[model samples]
Target: MASMFRAASVAFFCILSIAVADAQPIKPSASTQGFHSRARLIGGGQQGEHWLAGIEITLDQGFKTYWRTPGDSGLPPRFDWSGSENVASTEIRWPAPKRHEDAAGVAYVYGKQAVIPVLVKPKDPTKPIRLVLALEYGVCKDICIPANADLTLDLSGADSERKAIEAALAKVPLLQKLGAQADLSILSIAPVAGDKPAFTVTIQAPPGTKPALFPEGPENWFFSASHPAEGDRFTVTIEEKPKDVSGPVPLHLTLVAGDKAVETEVSLDENGKPR
Candidate 1:
């Protein structure tokens, strides 16, 4: 009877050991070297029903990278995950970006380091996932250099990089409805009549905070950064309006102030009124 009890105890200990091993943090994949930069894939364990991951780019001092909407004269990062397995869908989240004005033009960029958070939904959550990413982006100092990287990782356990991923996630702008009433929100949008059609935006922000606006419109449409016209009022002019496209234009606007940020979408007609 004592021998039987010992055998059962040993079996229970083995199962516990396996569970602990599975929960251990996974190491980041090998980095792909680039000019004054390096890129790699990092697992961030699981968050609720979906798995979290990050594409970490470490840049040398004085080097920077572009955001999803590279304001004026930069290349945005492009990601391809056709080589991945067990991924049903993947969503890349962009953190609030900073505005930089140089000879090239006003651009939105990240300096020093950038970690882009990715939320991946697995086709089968019970099975292990193999994440493979093909990334193409640009790093700029004085001149811009295009870079590419191929990174892969088998994600079945937690990762030590989870904390870093969460930090990036915190910077991602929260989604809010257009004209939402909040301490930091877009109060109103109106049409500005000029040589070129423009929109005037009024935002509500905390006192002593300087706010900036980033606007994204339909394909082939480019807009200038919101220029402050007066107190709490800014104007965004249409730079390049797509040819042969008429009717209402949809705008995705991101507003950032100090440590608060939010994103909202609205559509306007030729008259600049909400459509």
Candidate 2:
């Protein structure tokens, strides 16, 4: 009986070691001559309702990553979280993007190392959460490289790493403010020609202010190359819907003046125009 008990203890120890090793944090890696990416869970215990996760992308010395709008030359980042359990929803808050122009054209994006913050809410407060993200993005140098990565993060309610997560969450407020203070009165949206359903938006930026407009919803309804025209006013052609699209479509705009950012929401008019 004594020998049997000792053997059982040894086996348990080995299993515990394997489990701990499997839970180690993931490191960034590169597949091609492009960008390297890493993801990790940050805060878990401070707030019982939500946790923070950070995804960082380090572009190779000369390569660049695409923005939410990848312009005409790159592919936008794609994320999938079908395997996540105990997660109510994941919210990705992006930092303000900059405008980059080369021989191809002017593109808006974040270069170098960009830290994207994600908020994860768990359905059960007592259970541990597993988040699996399948991400695909394009990195451009002289040529563009399409890359994919699988990122996993285990969230524990009692983890000590929560402190770092909370710090990252602090930077998100600036981005949130950028999405909340756009000057909507400068934009005039109206139905356009063609029966296929479309609209034209003329944006008037304040003198010396170059603003870019980003639509918050109905992702399929707008054109991909809606660049904000510079000068006293700008105009962008957007594809409208035959009728109001299902669900709620909140027209959130992001206005950037140099390094300053502001956001505003535009409500739909009675005629389906962006008011």
Tens digits of per-residue lDDT for model 2, 172-232: 3233321222442334556656544345555544456665654444555543324554442
The C-alpha stretches of model 1 lying farther than 4 A from their native spots are 1-29, 270-274
Q: Candidate 1 residues 1-275, lDDT tens each?
A: 99999999999999999999999865435578888999998888988888989999999999999999999988899999998899998999999999888898889999999999999999999988998888899999987889988889877677789999999999999998877889889878888678877878888878888888999988788888655667588888888876576667789889989888999888967544456
C-alpha root-mean-square deviation, each candidate: 12.9, 9.3
- State candidate 2's TM-score: 0.61
| Predicted model with the maximum TM-score | 1
lDDT against the true structure, per candidate, is: 0.87, 0.59
Q: Any residue pairs clashing in model 1, and if so which?
A: none
Return the lDDT, model 2, position 93. 75
Model 1's TM-score against the true structure: 0.86
Q: What is the TM-score of each predicted model, taking all chains together?
A: 0.86, 0.61
